[model samples]
Target: MLKNIAELNVIVDKYVHWFNHERISLKTKGLSPIAYREQVLGN
Candidate 1:
């Protein structure tokens, strides 16, 4: 169970990275979600 939990955490992290950094969003002129939020919100 512990090992499975660790693996799941890693997979979740990878998906999060892909969603935030790799996928381009249309709302911010085709920038990744992370970049768009940073630009609009001021990181």
Candidate 2:
């Protein structure tokens, strides 16, 4: 469990960054979710 709000925020920030820029999956053809969406949407 998180120790405090600051710690929780750190975890949240890490996940958010990962989700947007780092995390990848085979389903998206090895791209991060946002990147794959942008590619598909032509953003």
TM-score top scorer: 2
> Global lDDT of each model?
0.89, 0.93
Regions more than 4 Å wrong, model 2? none
Clashing pairs in 2: none
Error of 2 at 37 (Å): 0.6
Candidate 1 backbone collisions, by pair? none
Tell me the tens digit of each residue's lDDT in model 1 across 1-43: 4478889999899999999999997877999988888988989
TM-scores of the models, in the given order? 0.68, 0.74
Clashes of 1: 0
Query: What lDDT tens digits, residue by residue, belong to model 2 across residues 1-43?
Result: 7789999999999989988888999999999989999999999
